[model samples]
Target: MDDRVAGALSLPEDWPAHPDLSLALNRMGSFDWDLDSGLMHLDRPALDVFDLRPEEYNDRPADLGQRVPEDEGARLDTMLVQALEAGQESYGAYFRCRLRDGSLRWTHTQGFIRRDADGRPRRILGIVRDASQELADSVARQELDEERRRRTSLVQATSAALAHARTVQDVIDVLKNSRGLAHLGAANIVMGLLEAGRIHLVAEGPEGSFVPGTRYTKVDERYPMSEVLRTLTPRFIETPDDFARSYPELWGQISHLGVTSAAYLPLIAQAHPIGALGLLYDDRAVFAGDERNLLVSLSSSIAQSLQRAMLYEQEHDLAEGLQQAMLPRRIPEVPGAQVAVRYRSARLGRDIGGDWYDVIPLPGGRVGAVIGDVQGHDTHAAAVMGQLRIVLRAYAAEGHSPATVMARASVFLQELDTDRFATCIYAEADLTTGVMQMVRAGHMEPLVRDPDGSCHKLFVEGGLPLGLSAEFGSLDYPVSTVELDPGHTLVFYTDGLVELPDTDLDGGMRLLTEMVRNGPQDIRRLADQLCESVDGYGGEDDVAVLLLRRDAVPSPQPGGRLRQHVAQNDPEALSSARHMIRAAVRAWGAGERADEIELTADELITNALLHTDGGAIVTIRILAGGERRLRVDVEDRSSALPRRRDAGDAGVSGRGLMLVDRLADVWGVESRGGGKCVWSEFLIPERFERPGRHEPPAHHELPDRRDRGGRDRGGRDRGGRGGAGRERPGGDGAPREP
Candidate 1:
């Protein structure tokens, strides 16, 4: 049998079959190859499937080839070539092949090669099936599923618009205008809450569109919207007639606003009806079920946002209370001063402004006055204000001068490392002297209102605000001093009282002047009047006030006026010390140690001139009352700290501290700012005469009175009587005994 023949022929060879294969010659839907002739044949159905005819297949052009997509066709051709050349058993694959009609179709081809007896391929045969429709349907189904996934993703993306909403208004705004929803409608959303019996507008969308008037009052008993809100049931109407039938009273208002339909959903926050949301439309058509579902979902988000907003309000209240407690409850009493104070917080929120004032008492019957503002408007500012106030009191109590007090406080503020800066005014006044001195650290100067209605502003120069200048050398604050007249009031306050937008600072000062001139006389009344008058000024920043009065002159005491006697130079100082030391020895009844005490006094005078910056002046006085002792005081400006020298110095280099410590009954150094002083005192002797200017009694001395000059000797006579008896142990290896 020929390899081109199958079991039977279903069609004639000349029939219009596909041109590439012999369908009529081979009726069976299979292909065969003749190993000897190298010719291939397919049955009728196989030829028809591939669109080839039996007559045309035999006379087909030698260059005619199956058309397939490049990658798949290349793979299939490689597999078939290997089977034909290498005598492989069979190969099969699905690939896209082009038909003679210029259309492409997918085919499944299974084929084998005929081999010669020497194991070499002589011909190849195959059969192909069209599977194009099945492959196209599978791909179409996968594309449809992918499109559905994309729609689901778009719906999930809408959730982000609601993420930033924490209030009913916020949610409504997001639903209407956020996430590109503004094109949905005119973006008009209204929020209402039930108060006192009716639904009152709490917030409205497209702001300023709905002008809430007297028609929207809460006490209205017959408003149709109020009834729907009170019932907690959702209501919908799509036309004027429908609206009248469902809510007769609201129909007129709705028609006036051109609203043809509306959906009302009750808002329940934390399980209670706080308000309701109404989605409105301008057309008469009713909304579908899915559109209503979206509105209902948005209502739930609004309810959650309302709950969070309520929580935030409660927390804000707590913070406000904490800020208020940090300030002083009331002004304090200063003996010779009048005080006043005021504080205000922001009206709309829990922002407590930082303004404070305090009047503190000090030793020596003085008072410290302060007014300051920390740079903020919250709990942190109030806290810093409290810390500054406490420190001010402590520093004032330590007997610091006005300038010193402010300078020290600036250093303290720099070390605190707070995030904000502060401006303060520190002043100290003595009740007894009627003298007022103040220092301003970048603060407004105080105003002085005299009894005669004259006003004056006290300004300080050359001081920086606290925390700005961190160096010690830059901390030199100047003090302003004035002799405040009797019945005058000094007013210290924060800038809030006078500063106003668009008004120059000088104008602010002038305004304060006018306020004082026309204000009340009582300090508390005046302070209240000024604050109330300036409430709208400067955006109502927090204000604080402090008032002070200089007291009347005090009565004088006895012995208040004593002549001061000062002696400088080494010789004059030593002579004064000896005279004073002799009087103390005689007065205290320590006659046995009179000579030693006098020698010690001489050493002290010489030490002051040698080691000190200059030869210091020494003063001597005798007290008739209050211990009745002689006194010697040395004043110097040296900054070095005093220490005791060892007693082993045979020479006279460092003998002052040692001798003074051993001889005086008590001794110590008192520290003043920038300097120190070493002071000591010895008990007076009873038998020793308080030395006169020139002489001492002859019976009290047993040695030569003159030192080879015929002048009175080391020990002078009480009555100038010559006692020229024996040579005394002098400075050149001489000793004298008392």
Candidate 2:
């Protein structure tokens, strides 16, 4: 027997056999191998380690090669053979073993090899210790280190994404793309703002949450969001039960949504809670402390960005409101013409500009159209524009010609001392005669389309812009007149329409004219197309366009007349006249003007009744031509003709004839066989007309003056030498002395 094996098989005389030692030895199973017989012997403890029955292994020694794993068994056999052949005292190897129960355990074996005199191995003794638990612990530590590095990288990426977010939606999109949050087990994310005691959902990621702009009352204490807002802290709900316990009413809804866990953090800005950020998980998940801290920090950055967006929105709304208020509330219903106007602001974050257009009702049935662009786009410029528009309207309404209006507006703007200039084009159109007169002040020329669908720009003479030096003289604006045949159109616009950055003015004008010429004939459709064509061309300036189309005459109606008898003293005659006018307008397919026509008819019939003692005859006629006209005639037995009187600031009664003068295209008195007739005409708007019709001259040509000390041949005083044969005040075919 080997000396080491003999010593392990016998006990020392004074050895104490401690229980702890016995237990330790049992945990480490012992194995003995007989090299000559090629069999292995395992003790009771070793049989327990392999889960083998004692009777099975005791009668037949187990195969050591089959007991260990194939590769490990090969390694152990080689080590034992080498040790015995070299006469080595001890040998050991670490390997995996598969027990009879079909489970694997890492085992390390060490033993003393016993050999004969020639160093041939006869028997082997070894102890097997299971090392499965220790090996598993080492692998887990390595995986944890790798996960930490990944999480750190994700947090850094998320921070960079949030820093560059520009808008509320941008911030939400960045949060939604957070791979780190998904890796850390967040399934859904939502961003909301608290306003007016309510939570407003601003953005939802990956999938929609409820609906955008969804509102929830913050006073509802049962909601987790409400609690988060109240406490201004972060909260983690670990399970459905936790949610149910805290919010019984909301538990059913939340459970139906399959949310097993959630985290809610308040979005704080400027040290105040503005809103809340939320993360939801379908499966139960626990958030680590560092992950929660990262989310909290992200919430702060998002809140700051959101606050800025909100402020910008508020200011945008205010600026838009101011601009809208300064524009025309409604386009006036001009006879024989259709007008369409459009205005668009600059891109977001830009101040509202002072580009404005107006359609004002001028005296003598003419319409005044104006478009102007101020020097700047600030609030000061907008204010100046508002004041300037009011002043222009006042001047135009006071019966001043287009040139006079432009000159007066320039003077008025200079008086304001705003230190800003503006370019404008003021035009007056006489619907009855199809004549349009315009005056430009350092502004673009008017573009006109003939009835033949051909277009050309009117190179009207222009003076200095308004608000410039006041030394440019009162009559500086030169008026240009053009005859608009039926179906003709006139376009007036600001520089924004034809002037782009680094682009030639001629090229821009050509582009505009081509667009207008090929555009639809309908005023509204043409306006829309023109605006769309130049939608993105105006870099920083605002765009404004005003279009006017001369309507063509409709086919004549069979019998378009309504007549009524009025008693001189009866008050019902006025009402009867108004009823007749309304019925006639409706029959003529011009019911839109029923209100204004009825009011005018009432005034005419009342004047006849108040001025004469005899009953009068009232007639309403809808004239059919290239331009339809509504003619109202009131005849009384009195020879006195209606006359216009000066109605100063406080005079209310004299405004009757003044209203007739301002509202009607033309009003005059004619002497009939038995009475004096008072008549007023209103041109009805037409849609289409026959082409190739010759346009009438705006006014007859006047004889040349000899310049005899600024006197005509008849020695009559010539008006300021501006132009000969200027349009008469009433826009009648006759000429008046200037």
Top TM-score prediction, candidate number: 2
lDDT of each: 0.60, 0.70
Q: What is the TM-score of each candidate against the true structure?
A: 0.41, 0.52
Give the number of the best model, judged by lDDT. Answer: 2
Model 2, span 9-118: residue lDDT tens:
87777477654356346566777778788677776666665556676565244345456777877777798779877788898877887877777877777888888887
lDDT of 1 at 190: 66
Count of backbone clashes, every candidate in sequence:
31, 1
545-657 per-residue lDDT for model 1 (tens digits): 77776655443111111111123443533443454445434433445556645654565556555656664444333334543344445555565544444446476455565
Model 1 TM: 0.41
Off by over 4 Å in 2: 1-189, 203-214, 238-245, 254-260, 281-284, 348-350, 445-461, 469-475, 495-540, 554-738
Looking at candidate 2, what is the lDDT of residue 94? 70
